[model samples]
Target: MTDLLETVIENREMVQPNHANMLETAHGGHVMKWMDEVGAMSAMRFSGETCVTARVDQMNFERPIAVGDTAFITAYVYEAGTSSVKVRLIAEREDLRTREREQTTESYFVYVAIDEDSSPTTVPELTVSTEEGEQLRRAALENEAE
Candidate 1:
């Protein structure tokens, strides 16, 4: 078994002109790419094997992250099936100087662990051992219910 907290991954990306759309804000594609990468990292940490994206439940973009702001992405494995890991991902826009942050996007993704032959492999069970981990898992479940 893997503690849910052990699967958490956090990453940051500087939103530059190259990653922005015509509106000078970070593009949705770039945000999604970051989410996917972080989600895979979390899944791999739990499974200890390569994982592939099986499905994306939903992606909600609450606001635009403008260029010059930092995009902070967080991912954690909340649930696991025989071979699939369910991940919750959140993206925040942070002003580095002021240290202000706001959630900009959220989503849930499912990843299937794969072995060397590219076949689906079993993954460890997910457990929430800390209060914070329990809260995080509960929040994700509630969001999905919404």
Candidate 2:
């Protein structure tokens, strides 16, 4: 089993004009790209194999992030199956001027591990070691709701 805390990963990107929409806010597609990239990284790190997104359980965009703000994306592997890893992802926007941050979006993504030949690959079990890990696991369970 692998400790899910050990699989937590974070990535950051500055929102550029090209990443903005007609409203001058960061485009939802661009944000989803960032989330998918970070989530894949977390899944690969947890599974030690290539990963492909199986499902985006939920994606909620709470606020808009304007161009020039830094998008901070954090992801962690919270659950695992024979070949699937459940990841929790959070995206926050940091105000460069005030140094304040606001969560802009959140989602739960499921990824399936794949072998070199692109076949489904088994993944190690997930271990929850700390209070935060337990909390995330519980949250993932609640988020599943089925």
Candidate 3:
């Protein structure tokens, strides 16, 4: 079994001009792609198999990451199915100078583990051992319920 906290992944991406739109804010597509990549990594860490994005749910862009800012992406597998892992993701806009961060986007992504033949593969059940892990699971479940 994989613990929720063990599957958590956090990464940062500098928002270059190419990553931004005409408004000088990070592009939605670029942000989505980054989240997908991070979510897949989180799922693979738990499943021990190659994973691909299967679905994205409730994606909301609450704010934008401006050019020259750092985008902090966080992902974690909160639950598992026969072959699918449910991941919770968050993106925050960070100002390195002031060390302030505001959440820019949030979403849930589902990934399915695949075998060498590209067939869906089974994954171990998810476990929540620590308080932090349990808290993440509960928050994700509650958001899912909404």
Q: Kindly report which residue stretches of model 2 are placed more than 4 angstroms away from their true locations once superposed.
A: 144-146
| Candidate 2 structure quality by residue, lDDT tens digits, 14-127 | 999999999988999999999999999999999999999999998999999898899999999988989999999889999878989999998999999999899999999899
Give lDDT tens digits, candidate 3, residues 45-71.
Answer: 999999998898889999999999999
**Model 1 — which ten-residue stretch has the worst lDDT?**
137-146
Clashing pairs for model 1 are: none
lDDT of each: 0.96, 0.91, 0.94
**Number of clashes found in candidate 3:** 0
Clashes of 2: 0
**How far is each candidate from the true structure, as Cα RMSD in Å?**
0.6, 1.5, 0.7
| Poorest 10 consecutive residues by lDDT, candidate 3 | 137-146
Best by TM-score: 1
lDDT of each residue in 32-87, candidate 1, tens digit only? 99999999999999999999999999999999999999999999998899999999
